[model samples]
Target: MRWAGRGTEPEAVERFYAVIPAGGIGSRLWPLSRADAPKFLHDLTGSGQTLLKETWDRLSPIAGDDRVMVVCGRAHRAAVEEQLPKLEDRNVVLESEGKDSSAAIGLAAAILEHREPGVIIGSFAADHVIGDQRRFRQAVVEAVAVADAGYIATIGILPSEPAIGFGYIEGGQKLDVPGTTAAYAVTRFVEKPDLATAREYVESGRYLWNGGMFIARADALLDEMAKTKPQLVAGLRRLAAAWDTPERGVVVDEEWPRLEKIAIDYSVAEPAAAAGRLAVVVGEFPWDDVGDFASIAKLQSGGRGSDLAILGEHARVLADSSSGIVVTDRDRLITLIGVENIVVVDTEDALLVTTSEHAQRVKSVVDALKLSGRTDVL
Candidate 1:
């Protein structure tokens, strides 16, 4: 984003801490995404950088490298560190086990709050794709302004279609929030609706796609979380107190697994919206969470020369009147003939074959593997 003044930073970014919660082993994008090396570690968008690196490139200018923090699972520690070599040892916090979103983000907030009381922190998902950096940063500045006003602020994407894959944010009245072009009061957050309901929401013009982006002061987030989940707040506070000390390992191992396992939406966001403590800034940028193979196909880089969307080398695939998305993870050539709307993932060990219509159900294949004790593939 261009600044009005010469050599100046964006508004409210001095104290803004961009906390990246890099958890979750993407199961739907499995075979390519695994427990040891998740999707964030790979270049899913065909960009030179990985998803996590792209996330850094977006926020580092606003939050600086010193204020950026990453939280991830213990298993992916070496990989994350290798990707982010400049990240400080104290900035990257590792969890002993995956305790869901609430624990991962809340722990990061508590630790930052211990260092600086009431610091502005924004949490962005690691695997989302943003097409417009200028519009996204503009929304971030507005969200930080809303956070300064003591509301748990979120940057909701303006819907381009009636997409049922993402949750919806209902906006209420517009408020004259300081340091913002426009801010709206969030009425409530709704889960992914069916096709008919999603269409109704889009037609009503009262809904925005929830991209899981949240920004607020550390104290405000913790205090709001305390109302619904006091036990989680207490345990996180204990762990935060010992985070910068030598006892960090001992405290995390002892209190981390015992913390409440829940998503931040249930723990703070939904309740805060009901009480009028949540606000939203509309993001004009094109965004996607990259959840399934269909989204992958759409985000794939190509000029529509054919119906095929390939994520790797064109030489890897030799198609004959076949149209689908092919993700080449190995050096072997993949040949297809007379295929339509198909999703083919070729890897070294496992391969995923399905259609775009059934891409969302790929997680059930992982479930079946678990049920049959086929941990080798998962």
Candidate 2:
């Protein structure tokens, strides 16, 4: 991880573009994170800005307003634009349907590469809460340098705990890069392991949590993908050729569905790692996907994980010798009396009551809602 203080002014990262793949309803966040209104569209962190807007605020300085692009489903095109008014309409890469990260990110890379040959583009999830923008930008700058050195660069978060919820990246053979961020060739990417394995991974010191930030030259990213998914790359190129033209909709309708529905990790990253073409830049700045209510609790608590986090007009929820998380919309008064480690989410059509310990199971609740045909509340 690159350790540094926040700078006075962040300089624009030259030749570096950013793509935010704003897809996926955070199901674990349930009642709040609905299909039409996802968590990214709300201020889950109680930061007075939606997660997407926060992401833009942190990234725009580095990539510039014009250079930062958003790849989102057509359903979210309006929300993305509404949150980031400075973003150009042409920069919003609208997907007719969800085709996962590879299509979204790959198409962005294809268009950027076609427009400007060697621009370094980074794909960061729009919903991620990244603290310490100075350090994040510094790490990104280092990642760009690593990418310029002809390697697929990724940011790996330094593991703070034996987290079994995220993937792990093993750093091997440090690269000789004269830089601040520690750059290393990724030995392998491991999936979320068991609790015991996660503990071992944390203890090993060679492993870092996969923060899922990929930065590389647009051509280099596609060239690497060409090695494994050549046809996907070809389809993306065709789509890119029509990206800025009047035929964008026609081309997207014709080819987007046919393009591979795999993730960038499978389409390019993992393969590149195996071929010794992937590097991981250590990331130390605070980051979180806000995967569940537990995650939201942490973000809302101002880093004091044990504090009772109340989001959205906390004054309405009365607490009497109780501690936990309570999220309300001011529709009704909620009285929590002698309740410990409890979570209460009150929405118009749905309410979720669970403890932080059971927050991970919220996705199961969402799944059940879908199975029971109660998706309207979902």
Candidate 3:
């Protein structure tokens, strides 16, 4: 049988170009995920592989060696290079100034456009955790089919809990597209709801947690930005116009300082979602944004009632810690005696202690430190 959009012909698997935005300094993880050591670099789940490495492994098969790109800040460039030295320096586009996701994704889009026209690009966050790789790849394949149909596709995580921290996508109407089983025509893009609203959404069964994973053709995304966010488009275009030139590439030292700072969600995704120009796939994988310490804890083996003994019972203990996190750099002897719903993070310079429920507000602490010019702790 032929695919829906391909019209009586078996649709080919779309060539994928992955763009990983690895530029954030995770303050929630505090001293562990500091400015010098970004969250993507840390062993998020006590696994040997870091978050960034896990993301790369998932995308490497789909995007191949040259097609995968990582966009990060200049400060973290060498570290990122050390992590993934196989990727060329040019492919690892660095922002001289720390702009948000908007400018970062725009730069990535422009670079990919120069390489492949109408290429399907997957924008994966550098700090997410997916439990099942097979299911994750299946979702990507489905999203690619949706993108090939001239739609900006985003994967919506199946919300197991009423998470007020995540934005919600209402998706009930299945789109009639090929190469996909459950692609939805997005009806509404809801902002992060309050606890009450989030509860309602969970009950309604019409919403999925905004996964922050997006897929679209490079040109399509740029076109949407041009229509919805003209100024942002203009700024990116000006920077991209000189992309191949020796002047810009040789001395981004000068060119990058000129680009504006904004997040891709504000610049592109939110606006496009508001304008009814986005598609959503209810991703069939166990997914977590890993935005906070608690989320990371849940993904690991010692989550709920599970004894994950890297050592003896006395050495490692995570018992009855609902909605909490416990991590220590001291591998010799680390144990949580009796704690419920708390974040315990011990690092070289700082030790963070906070309630698990207050995980979302952790970013504010990072913000406060930055406001006070505490880059040493950041």
Candidate 4:
């Protein structure tokens, strides 16, 4: 974990860092994803392990347990530690408050740079699910190789559909990287588009869903931040300097609140792409961020019954002429009669009933709850 000079180690033997940014409430999941226990802490797929733990499992083989780091809020530090017991205490970077992804990932990059020069770091979200582990590892390996060549690399998931929920990356010329077969120069990063635009993007075959996975040398990432978000870079560098010292907590408490709240896309990736420093590796693996309840249903259904999906093990669902989705954490029997395209989420304290089409609007329920000052349920 000490700094060896740049180019001292071979590309294969060089250290690669995996940074997990675990700091979202997942409001679209509503009652299931709450303030104390977020979506990342739950096993949405009933896989027996939480999403955060699964993320760690996926990255530990590529980066090793010692090199993997998680940047999360101080409030959820205990939960993160509980879920990932094998994670070293020092590898968990705690933010005093939520300053968004730019601060989270930039601080992690700055700290990693301070620890070891010429280190490659990849930032992945804690709540995403990857179906093909082999393809995921392959994509990461290619991304790291591209990063080693002095470019900011990202894993661009091959779009299986015209999804308007996620952003898109337009790839330009194909790169001639040695290890990767489908590396491309990133032309631009576009936001989530309308239905017609998404259709056009998919039909054109030049676009990939932006999976939010970014890889780069720690020094390079910090340098990019220095150009676009100089003040954040300065603060992160200052905090990183004191990271291992006794004043770490004091410095973080003082500096973290003052940092600007911005996302890494706006702070670095977009600007860097415009400056011709971004590269992307095509990730053909099945990937989903599980943004809403409809996505969860799709994941659980296995495409067998698109009209009806059940999401819990103990949910004794009796559907008679009913079709849609039902999710229950309790052991009680759930009966649906003559219902169509409806969603029923039964928890101990909260019950959400809506249509499958309105699954994306669950966040509105959370907003109304907040407006009513119903912190007890929220």
Report the C-alpha lDDT of model 3 over 279-355, residue by residue, as the tens digit: 89877677777777767756665446243323112234445434355676654444565656667766667778776
Order the candidates by TM-score, highest first — what do you get? Answer: 1, 4, 2, 3
Tell me each candidate's TM-score: 0.96, 0.94, 0.87, 0.94
Cα lDDT, all candidates? 0.88, 0.85, 0.75, 0.88
Q: Which portions of model 2 show Cα errors greater than 4 Å?
A: 1-12
Predicted candidate 1 versus true structure: per-residue lDDT over 1-378, tens digit per residue? 223331354456667999999998889998888988798887888887889999988887777777789999888888888887767788898988888888889999999999998789999998889999888888998899899988999999999889889999999999788778768999999999999999999999999999999999999999999999999999999999999999988987789779989999999999999999999999988899999888888677342424888886543788999877898767688899999878999888898999888999999998999899999988
10 residues in a row with least lDDT, candidate 4: 1-10
Better of 1 and 4 by TM-score: 1
Judge candidate 1 against the unseen true structure and give its global Cα lDDT, from 0 to 1: 0.88
Weakest lDDT window of 10 consecutive positions for candidate 1: 1-10
lDDT of 4 by residue, 171-229 (tens): 99999877788999999999999999999999999999999999999889989988988
Model 4 clash pairs?
Answer: none
